[model samples]
Target: MMYDQLKVLEKTIIDIKKKYQLVNDELNSLKQKPNTDPKELAALKTQLSNYRNEHDSAKKQLGDLDKRYQNLAEAHHMIGEEQDKLHKQLADLQRKNSELQQHNDQLKQQNHDIKQQNHDLQEKNQLAAERTQVVLKRLTRIDQMEG
Candidate 1:
């Protein structure tokens, strides 16, 4: 929208300048003429002055519009950079999360292996206790018989 406005202002300034030039040429021509009316010359001078003022105003407006456009462009570029940074951070976090998940799975497998080993050891301990009791009973029987 601002660009469109700038274009319009530029066109206006160009038109004003052309009109000013034409009036100036006509005034110069009248000055060279032997029979020129004072009223007409004065009117042309006034019109030329008005056109100059309008041209100046348009130029200032165009300058302001250009400044505003530059500011907006800078802001948009910064936002794009910030968005890229955020995406990179998100990717890094996702990669880290995946690594942690893999480590957790490894720990779970290790825990399961340890539990299985503990269960097997308990069964062996139980069998060993049973065998020890059987040997003690036999020893007692022999001792009583000898007595």
Candidate 2:
């Protein structure tokens, strides 16, 4: 029975000490609260509002810069596509130029062949005229002998 009474007394002492600590903490908080002046609080509020405006302005400027960067990226992509198109056109033109060169070479060869044929025909015509002259001379000699 005595032991139980001692336990109850010890518990009461612990609870009282906890209550005293809580009251002291509350008193200290109240003392500090009174030291914060209204003017200082207003000044802090104004500074916070200015910082908020500056932050918002910076965020808007960043958004505009991002938009400009995206536009530049799109323009660069379009330029790349145009460059590819020009390259393909250049290749096609090169192919056409080679084909034209081949056709010109064939025409030159045909002209050379025609000139050779004309030379051969002129030589044959000269030989036939010489044979006719020889035959006429022989006929004139025979007539003179018969007379």
Candidate 3:
């Protein structure tokens, strides 16, 4: 699951980078175009300004995603360590007495809950990825029309 999430993160970074380059190239192209009419030039300038805003917004979002990914990774590591500690405690309890069986069962349930939470996180990440893809496609379509 970590590997899958890593792959998705990597792909998202690549997609964002490509989009950034495309927007940069488009801006350069628009700037190089000669316009004799002041009104048309103003319109182009407005459009360019809009594009720049959108690009900046995208960059901020990418940064936000990177931060989220880092947080998730840290949480994952912490959870693993917690699970290991739980496993050790459970084993020690088992060796100490049969009365601790109830405690063991509770720990198992806690582990189950943790696993569910992890699964939910994964689902949320997947949904975020889908939304990102949709946004990217829409941006591409807009770029095509503008071009």
User: Candidate 3, residues 58-98: lDDT per residue as tens digits?
Assistant: 89989988997898899899999999999999998878777
Better-scoring candidate (TM-score), 1 or 3: 1
| Candidates arranged by TM-score, highest first | 1, 2, 3
> What is the descending lDDT order?
3, 1, 2
Tell me which of candidates 1 and 2 scores higher on lDDT: 1
Return the TM-score for candidate 2, rounded to 2 decimals. Answer: 0.60
What C-alpha lDDT do the candidate models reach, one value each? 0.79, 0.71, 0.90
TM-score of each: 0.67, 0.60, 0.53
Candidate with maximal TM-score: 1
lDDT for each residue of candidate 2 in 1-147, tens digit (9 for 90 to 100): 434544554565565556556655754565466447788767756755665565556556556555655666677779889999999999999999999999999999999999899899888888888888898888889989998
Instruction: Rate residue 138 of model 3 by lDDT.
Output: 100
Task: Estimate the overall C-alpha local distance difference test score of candidate 3.
Answer: 0.90
lDDT of 2 at 137: 89
Residue 129 deviation, candidate 2, in Å? 3.7
Better of 1 and 2 by TM-score: 1
Clashes of each: 0, 0, 0
TM-score of 1: 0.67
Q: Residues 11-92, candidate 1, lDDT per residue (tens digit)? A: 7657766765776686578567774777876886686678568657766765776686677667777988999999999999
TM-score for predicted model 3 compared with the true structure: 0.53
